[model samples]
Target: MTDSLDPVVAKFVDALNSGDRQAFYALLTDDATMSDDGNDRDLRQWTESEVFGSDGRMDVESVSDGGRSLVANYTNSRWGSMRTAWRFTVSGDRISRFETGQA
Candidate 1:
């Protein structure tokens, strides 16, 4: 059976590939939290900086799942290849909580 998270992950990948910060941020909640191997920062702040920064190119390699959460494989211009997991807590059509980490 097809994974329920496939479409959401696909949309995120598409946004990342396109370097569309607005679209990318739109996928996240206002209070979304993202934790990377490098630093602990809020998703909105990190994304905003990345969107405007000089070396913020993100190439999404693949997206997978671990039962409850989705994992995204990516290569950033500055960070190299890293696997990031996004655990989604959905509320209506939007995400109430988004926690990410290096997998």
Candidate 2:
């Protein structure tokens, strides 16, 4: 599944799975934005606590939108696992924004 992802999104997932904070952050645009459930979030802060700080990982169930969207079983130390939906907006090779929520 990872093989079919967009280059940037695949890198993001790989970074998540490997707990590579530098790689994870390198995939984003400096002004990247994110949402959780529908509300805007502070991207860096959220990524710190909810992702890198908590061991986040995803098991992708499906992909869509030319690999920019996915449905996955996502897990982290804080939230456990859930069927989650994610969408990414890319600007060139970097992810400019992303959104995720319970699916």
The superposed Cα distance between candidate 2 and the true structure at residue 44, in angstroms, equals 0.9
Candidate 2 TM-score, true structure as reference: 0.96
For each predicted model, how many residue pairs clash, with residues at least 3 apart or on different chains?
A: 0, 0
TM-score of 1: 0.61
Model 1 C-alpha lDDT versus the unseen true structure: 0.57
lDDT of 1 by residue, 1-103 (tens): 1144545544655676677768777776677566555466776667655443534443443434532366566455656667776665655455555566677
Quantify how close model 1 is to the true structure by its C-alpha RMSD in Å. 4.0
lDDT of 2 at 96: 95
RMSD to the hidden true structure, all candidates: 4.0, 0.7
Best by TM-score: 2
Clashing pairs in 2: none
What does the lDDT come to for candidate 2? Answer: 0.92
Query: Could you tell me which 10 consecutive residues in candidate 2 have the lowest summed lDDT?
Result: 1-10
Off by over 4 Å in 1: 1-6, 37-40, 49-68
